[model samples]
Target: MAVSHYTLPSAKLDKPAKLLIVAAPFYREIADDLIAGAKAEIEAAGATYELIEVPGALEVPSAIGIAERMSNFDGYVALGCVIRGETTHYETVCNDSSRGITLLGLQGLCIGNGILTVENEEQAIVRADPQQMNKGGGAAAAALHLIALARKWGGARKGVGFLPEAEELRIAGELKDNPTA
Candidate 1:
């Protein structure tokens, strides 16, 4: 497994950062483990997080979307477990939830998706354990990296669009005073 070679990304933000953790605890124990791992990672990075629980994985992304639109979180962590079952429901939940999270990320949201689409509970537990795969922590680290990148480049300006309103007004005034020149 590539697990042996995987290294967690180191992150340190320039300013205090707050994150929103949206957990879909349909599998309560798995979710708890994931949340624990994620919290440890966020704390270690010197960041704060607020956690909110939804019904299941399907709702995780929508919760994040709402938070992103109405709240002031710097990043988001999506935690959940979708264990494959006898019915096709597993595929639906897994695909839809993943697609939703991906769409949100594409829209420029800093999100760490820790939702586990596992074949069984054993796999979920193993992946969620902080000492093992620690997928939860990995997700948080991913989000932190994105957040740091956003902070680093988010303020940079290109050309005309970034000109301050005051500067634009000053330029306009100069143009008006020197109409003939």
Candidate 2:
């Protein structure tokens, strides 16, 4: 029932980061507003971003997944609007797109999901407005937080095979113990 949530300030980063915004422009105006807010948020966080358009909400996640595999972005923002009409297609779009984004996040990719699933255009407009609910900015903020978390825990190690150097040492040790030696 509530779209407004408490936002945490973005963490200060020692270095600049690059981000990708994979947006679905299904509702041109709505998507535009969402993208605006997301851009503003990313700028405020001092991160550079690239914007790419997909055909629909479902494709937004797929695009980010591809970028995660092939690109060097530190995080991603997914933007789209899925308005409910007189059909069950609404639920499918909303649920499946959201699930796809979640799965990507679980795979260690920092993603901000700003897709709006609403009963009507009015609700989407209200939520997408930068001066109102600002869901797009919220999503951007979420991604930034996750990126900070990733950076905080990055570097240093706990296990063998985690690094190539450690793996090679382990292989050498195994070879040393071989009976043929």
Candidate 3:
């Protein structure tokens, strides 16, 4: 299989913006690295964050829901590691957690899903290291991107809106036709 590559845009996060992190302790080794990377990124962005540890990936959604409702955080990050075994449990956990995180983001919450679903420990190792693949850092970057997009579009205090570049150009064209009218 070919290796998949991705790049994230660099954006400055709003300083002092509240952040909440929910991590799974089931895969302690990998989880630790992920948390470390995410924390470092959040701090580098000049934001303050709190971490809540859950038993495993399955419990992450409830923890996130509680934190989101309790604190006025601008964004949330969910970190976990699930390596597939010879059982169907892996599929359930991975799918449910992903769906839960997506729902949270859709509910006007900025969430960075750092959950790593890999085929084995080796894959997890590659993605969890702060200095290596850095999936955790990637999650933090995604959170910052969503936060910036939210601010530019408008806060959740108001409903989300979309104004495409082409739409802006069309409006400008109409305005120019009127001139001083």
Best by lDDT: 1
Tell me the lDDT of candidate 3: 0.83
**Model 2: how far is 129 from its true place, Å?**
0.7
Per-residue lDDT of model 3, residues 1-181, tens digit only: 9998868656665545777888997889999999999998888788878888998898887777777766677888889999999999999999999998888788777889999999999999899999998888778878877887888787575222344555556656865654443
Off by over 4 Å in 2: 1-4, 155-181
- lDDT of model 1 at residue 177? 65
Could you tell me every candidate's TM-score relative to the true structure? Answer: 0.83, 0.83, 0.81
State the displacement of the C-alpha of residue 68, model 3, in Å, after optimal TM-score superposition.
1.6
Per-residue lDDT over 22-106 for candidate 1, one digit per residue giving the tens place of the 0 to 100 score: 9998988888889999999999999999999999999998999888778788899999999999999999999999999998887
lDDT of 1 at 16: 75
lDDT of 2 by residue, 2-93 (tens): 79766687767667778899899989999999999999999998999999999999998889878876778888999999999898999999
Question: Root-mean-square deviation of each candidate, in angstroms?
Answer: 6.4, 5.3, 8.0
The clash numbers for all candidates, in the given order, read 0, 0, 0
